[model samples]
Target: MDSIRFENVSKSFGKTKIINNLNLSIEKGERLILLGPSGCGKSTILRMISGLETITTGNLYLNGKLANDVDSGDRDIAMVFQNYALYPHMTIEENVGYGLRIHKEKKDVIRQRVKEAIDILNLTGLEGRYPKELSGGQRQRVALARAIVKRSDFFLLDEPLSNLDAQLRGQARKELVRIHEMYGQTFIYVTHDQIEAMTVGQRIALLNGGDLQMLDTPHNVYHRPANIFVAKFIGSPSMNILTVKMDGRDLVLGGQRVELPEMWQKKIHEKEGRGLKMGIRPENVVFSREKGPYSVKVNIHYVENYGNRVGFYTEIDGEELISIMPEDEFAKGEDVYWNILPEKLHFFDGETTMSIGYPAELS
Candidate 1:
């Protein structure tokens, strides 16, 4: 049975919908990330699971039991919030052990559990320091430690590392994975950061404007997005999308024509004369000095140095595209040859903005 299942779940506040027909299943001991932009209902989904927010319609099941009416405190779920919801007056030790104490645990047991959580979170030295005395990252860890001590079957985090610096956030991500492995609990983490979703999640449930966009393993989500929204949302520089018309065995992008590979020609032959959108990741756009079979000449309008890699920005007709290359080989205003492999190409239906399926090899 699934640890948590949302059966056509939806949420609304004062007639304003926040979550729309979300059907999802989270396996026991799986780390699932709810990822999307702000106001996309990722956090709202987390809250619904935690019973902090009520479902407007449909059912929620926890461990195969309907949980629509379960009390938040009776759910046996521990959550870490984005704000590091720590008590200002309580020391780190007190805050970490407060939950256990409230449950009527013996003092000795609370002490031992608090110590273990503190040590795991690297908060041993600051046990007596209050939340106000701690750094943002430290407080965030303390909040996590509090949830860890609960040893609940379900663990939820709402952007718990958003307050930390980049380096600290990276470290915290590793720590979270380690903690999850140790406990083997069902973890539902909500974040707008794609890096966190890509690295921490066993599977990602991406949302957009209250609708579930895609739910799949990170690799598949990155490589085989469900629609145009997902394809543009997951990548760092975002995929380059252009309108193209299928002409016989060629795809016409503005005035430029690209002869489709023999295999792709057979696959999309039915789409001939139809309008479609072509997508390619910036990293997949190869730079070459010599012309290839699929090569196109483009003048670099701008160049951005990203330390390890460089970004070459150019326009084909009126549409802008970015290409990431390892080294800075061409200067701004220089005309360069670029090509995309057949396997790297993504096609979307023009009218619906949904994927038109990949080549046979990738299908």
Candidate 2:
């Protein structure tokens, strides 16, 4: 089993901490993604697992054995870097078989494994070409083929697709999933792209400032964010957060009032007279010509056309809010009523910014 466990592991460069006390586990054959913005210690965590970076404190277990002091070459890990890291002078075939050659494998075994990797990554006809002769996508495939030929127990990728164009990145993501399914290796991918993290990972470990923000399936992270940070960070347009005050059976936002459902009324009755942050995704904001239950009136200030969809920007109180609509039926300066479903609402504590728990339907 090629499982990895980090028990209270921390890393620091002099006095600057790169990874705080972190406890995480990756099961054998699990495809996990370390996702965060730049300088969030995601890459640092990946390096620690690959034995390229030393842990400053705590224990690291690989396959139920302590591996904090293990050598990088003996870790049985294959890594694919962001730059594709291919030897410019080596032909595609030579590059794919380089690891095997270095390990002193028989020539025949090396040739067969190289051929298989080439075919799997759709580089069969380009085997004779050098890295400079291939496109960005092809060179990336060659890099992947090289890693695949190693057949290491652990496969680590550090933003491997960051250099590719959007279309190529999407295609490469699917290829990665197919390859992982075929090999069943413990794949640990690192990326700042949310689309890649959501699609490629079986589970995502979101990090911020060397601290783990949330660790869960993509669906949960999207729909049930743990706090205001996760709520604002995960979504594209991000969840619209507004300061609201509990008033009797209604929540007051600036000058507008939204009646709370029975469930929420009961849940936040204790918080009456106190301030809270209300969260609603742009997609969840419904537009109607006439005012209805829990509706708030606002004038659209700007409209952005996205072909299949439109983004309507408006202001509530003093905070800007956006709503995504399927069509552009309303123009700027038009007054519209918008409301969110009771189950779609998320509430956070004003002081801590932590979630106050979801309603029964969402929970």
Candidate 3:
């Protein structure tokens, strides 16, 4: 196992800056995920680590040795791209043991390693099949088998599941996790899908517009987001953000007065009536038929049922708010009351886009 580190790393292409002073560390045997939207530099970071892209500045270390100058083939890393890059003319066994063949390892040793990898990936019966004869998932397993058969120091997966269907992606994710467990090598994966990042990564590094936003576990990133961008980006049903003006102990939202939590009220009192943006997740919104501390009557625009839960698409005071409920409970176009709990609410300064109501000590 090898530990990977990048310090003050920057990369550029002509006039465009792709990565900016990015610093990250992947411990030995860690599963680190680089997550962001398209053009956010996630793939750039992965390529830089694999020596495919030259860094404009900064130091990169692999197992405590400088690696920025290392050649891609000498880096002792296996890369799996989105498109399964397999040899069409070679059988699965040949494709998996090609490196060993080129290096001229003992034939029996190569056979043993290939058999073990095929068994682990559940590709044993298809070893004699050519690439064209196998399914997409089977071909992907061949790619994985080739990567693991070499016993490389690290695995760099660049959205390897992106080409598979949703169901296949799910199955492949489980297989990847099983592979990680079987071989405790550091695995660095890149993906634009937040769901993939959340489910696969031990810890995720979030990027946006060439900047690193937050690096944390999925629970902390979802529940205690470092900034508004993270809070808005990580959740499936995006968090609801409302712009409101502070009015002493009350926050004014669409001409309606709403009381603030004591901690938030104290901070607003110190700020002196400044406007703020408050975030609330969809699951936190409680639907009711009675009056509450902060009640809003909303028109139910639509309801989408997905198995066990339903997503109620609605508009409140001209702002969109989605509420998730039990699938069998409600109907569309029904008038309903909604309220969000204080603990579930997050305050952000409108100017800085930074989280508010957090203990000053934490800052």
Candidate 3 structure quality by residue, lDDT tens digits, 1-363: 349988999999998999999888888998889999999998899898889999899999998899989998888888898898999999999999998898788999999999999999898788888999998898888999999888888999999998889999999999988899889789999999898888889999999999999999988888888879999998878888888777777877766777776766776666554557878898887777776887766667788888888888777567788888775466678877777577677777778777765645333
lDDT of 3: 0.85
Poorly placed runs, candidate 3 (over 4 Å):
267-274, 328-333, 357-363
The TM-score-based order of candidates, best leading, equals: 1, 2, 3
Better structure of 2 and 3 per TM-score: 2
As a TM-score, model 3 comes out at 0.93
Q: Residue pairs in steric clash, candidate 2?
A: none
Q: Which residue pairs come into collision in candidate 1?
A: none
Q: How far does residue 360 in candidate 3 sit from its true spot (Å)?
A: 9.7
Selected candidate, larger TM-score, 1 vs 3: 1
TM-score of each: 0.97, 0.97, 0.93
Looking at model 1, report the run of 10 residues with the lowest lDDT sum: 266-275
Q: How much is the lDDT of residue 169 in candidate 3?
A: 93
Pairs that collide in candidate 3 are none
In model 1, the Cα lDDT at residue 239 comes to 92
